[model samples]
Target: MAAAPTRIRAAVVGTGAIVSGSHLPALRALADRVDLVAAVDVDEERLAAFRALAAEPDETGPGFTVTGYTDLAAMLDAERPDLVLIGTPPSLHRDQTVAALRAGAWVLCEKPLCLTLAEYDEIAAAENPDGGPYASVVFQHRYGSGAVHARDLLTGGALGAPLVAHCQTTWYRDTDYYAVPWRGRWDSEGGGPSMGHGIHQMDLLLHLLGDWTEIRGMAGRLVHDVESEDVSTALVRFANGAMATVVNSVLSPDEVSRIRVDCADATVELTHLYGHTNDDWVYTPAPHTREAADRVAHWRTPAADLPSSHAAQLSVLLDAMRDGVRPPGSGPDARRTLEFIAALYKSAFTGRPVHAGEIAPGDPYYEAMHGGHPDWAPAAATAATSATAATSAKEQ
Candidate 1:
């Protein structure tokens, strides 16, 4: 008798909104390659809804059973799936991912890997061999065709050396948007625009520009009652000597997400309207002889239809799990992105430039309190708050 084809057994930890919206659909589409074995969520209602969605008949009209669990530990102990998708909130990521890896399940966690650089480092250290059953953060932007093409041009020296990059990510979030209890809280969601909305852009910038050597930034809660900043801007100097300016905000009336890279040879620009969609891109080559120009133009054909960020990322992750290889956007790669944001916050509060290695694990800011949130504020901001609290107590 012929042996059954192998399929990567899969389980998802969080069945919240994103899981139902993007992840469930994407995984179902890859049914032949992946088996949806189990799902876990604290909320029973959410778990039931997601299980029902997952168990529905496929296009071929065949139903599949997806086990549901309210307790993550129990599910892991029983299923021991090959891959685990963590779609939990930012604050819970560190603990969940560490547990998943310890259970011998490879993890594909959602973006802004954790709330702080400290959490990122902790999870990275916990991921045993740095490869399989390890963790991969979901920075879906890295999978877009435009991103792939741009990376080739930048890394292949086709665009010479990167000189400067301008990144802007703006989206509208009104009072109603903060209705969720943890929506704008420092401990729950991390920070405001910089950590939540701007993370994707920051990942793209780091992927394109290499390491950051220094950063100076400013952030504030200009438009919201949230504990974290609603707007932020930062100036970064890359290790390669290229400079960049990043702007992140949720108060913009007209939302725009774009990154323009100016290289020694030419310039490349890409923009997306929504968080997950790539709308347009422009690639310009430096002036050259007629023959050279023709060749460059021939190489630069019109942009083609590309995979959506989530789809592309999911495909690569599944492929990696099956082949026993590390995905390009591993947890370590995603850590750099989070570290950059941590530096940005530190600089914003201190009014001083922060270096790459400035926020070490032992740094006071690595574990500090802001407002009522422990270890949630930027180091400098936490110090300021502590002083104020001390003064208030003295007056009493």
Candidate 2:
């Protein structure tokens, strides 16, 4: 094991709900190891709330001062923290990540790195190798016990070759949910449910299944009055020859985030929304196969009770950073998830199947997520009537 930094001076940008709910709490949990040096946001009210974090520890402990800044660059120049947690809207990710890395700070960026492949590449370019600062995107589900255990079984051949899978993130997001200026805009949030919501489930799916070869899908604004699609469905083909069906929607009343992978010998599944523990995973061995059943009985499982959270991944990230290794969520690892989304969108908007690496600079989709679809436009008001007269479903 590598020796962690004696004291990591950390700063956080964007004082939104995710920052308060997950990032600040996680940082506080590591209060002994990380110092809350600075908080940056445009809103002073949010910054005031973050200022309260400095008062968390009693006078006896490391009672440090945390400064608030409206400008990220000024904070970067002043505090120069070891880590910077970015929980801002997606549109700002690229510029902020580039600036953070340039400021010699390890970055813990939120999900959906940027709105386009071009932006993704730009962020990747900012990463300085040769023992310089790095950036890690947030895909917390991949760090959960459930996902880790299931990945081990599949890779170790305990679950046999993965044949098929289903990734679903169906959550209810009212029109008011998109009322926030940046909530549903393609330029801001990237894509709708696929980028914001299902991206977590999809990241976990890709983490286990490996690289996806190609995908064909469709996206639509079925309900929510937004610039981006309210729902999206994709048929993805993995490099291992396993195909999966992906559905992301903000219209489901009974919300559920699930990923079920069926292998030749057994079926492994996980069901959870937002986060998951080891108990959320289940194993079902192949029926009527004595050899498979016998092997399944002895299959190894994760013994620890690790829950899915920012702390889970952040702790590990800090460990790696101390050891001088690039963290998990950035670079190629997180980029793959973004690439998968890009391919799915290109396929949907262009009415054609999109192979991996198909979209690049100059590609219509590379600039914007909607890919300049001729018919698609942001809805002023959600179409209340249902469009189920016939159907608009695509299955793998």
Candidate 3:
């Protein structure tokens, strides 16, 4: 019999809701393949709560008895885990990732990996020169069975050349949602829905559509009283001559996450709020000929129904770790998505279309997403400034 694969030792860096709800569950599901040894958080109370929560029994067996730590460096030195799952805020991602990589641990980080292109470069610089300790972002939407099928079809020319596409991530977040200190700030959460919420769909769109050449975008503080834009929209031109429109908003009541691709032979769409299964996707063939219509049957034939979840991506990452190879959603692939985001923000703030490779070293946007523009100030700050000025004028 072939030797059993070595189970990797994994550690999680945060005990917040995302970690408890997604990362911990994923580790439990893959328990046979991973040993979660430690968890870290700044808050002692939250850390204790997380330990209690992890102690709960489940089908995967008795809960993962993980040691909790307040300092990440201490956890790294003590645990020396093979894999680190980062579920912390966007601001802390660069430093945490670099620390993990230097300690010879592969990282699977949550979305909006870092605040800017420069920060991304810093994290990337920390990886092993070969490939063993590479860091990958968690873009789960690309792992679903439907997405895999669509990628094969679209890239293999089965769906014909993709000409146009639409990607939307519209969800509602009221004042209470932004009550968290880091929620609405550009420095912490990155750039609103375009970076935080819509990024999942945006990454998936880029995954299917290939490289983007240029972006023309607009953003506004439409509704919510926050520093970042409540809504953003962009027109993207791809290297393959495909054009796409992207909309990211946190102001919509009827929440939906959607992506549609119009190819020469068919139209492919996947619609779901947070996660998607095979059932959420539909492929419609152009009725130009009987043979073209007949191909729809093959497209509808279901593969293994793997839903897009943290586990799905983790499974792939685990395989890569075992093989000692770099995985998808890492290195240049991740940078592409990050660069596109920076381009969108630059275009939105500067009122000019931004191109790929335009925001390189020394570029203001390379160091920060807002590019140091006064126009990009948060609405809350701007409002307060105006109020103060009005009161001073009346007193004078």
Which candidate wins on lDDT? 3
Error of 2 at 271 (Å): 0.7
Candidate 2 clashing pairs?
none
Query: All predictions: root-mean-square deviation over Cα?
Result: 4.9, 6.9, 6.0
Over 34-125, each residue of candidate 3 has an lDDT whose tens digit, in order, gives 98889999999999999998878676445878899999999999989999999999889989999999998999999887888999999888
Q: How much is the lDDT of residue 213 in candidate 1?
A: 93
**Could you tell me the TM-score of candidate 3?**
0.93
Counting clashing residue pairs in each candidate, in order, gives 1, 0, 1
Q: Given candidate 3, what's the lDDT at residue 42?
A: 95
TM-score of each: 0.88, 0.90, 0.93
Per-residue C-alpha lDDT of model 1 across residues 280-383, encoded as one tens digit per residue? 66777767423477546733553664654666787888777666767777766776787788788888877799899777755644643133223345465657
lDDT agreement of model 1 with the native: 0.78
CA deviation > 4 Å runs, candidate 1: 1-5, 57-64, 275-279, 287-291, 302-305, 368-396
Cα lDDT listed for each candidate: 0.78, 0.83, 0.89
Please identify model 2 stretches exceeding 4 Å from their true place: 1-4, 57-64, 288-294, 297-300, 377-396
Better of 1 and 2 by TM-score: 2
The TM-score leader among the candidates is: 3
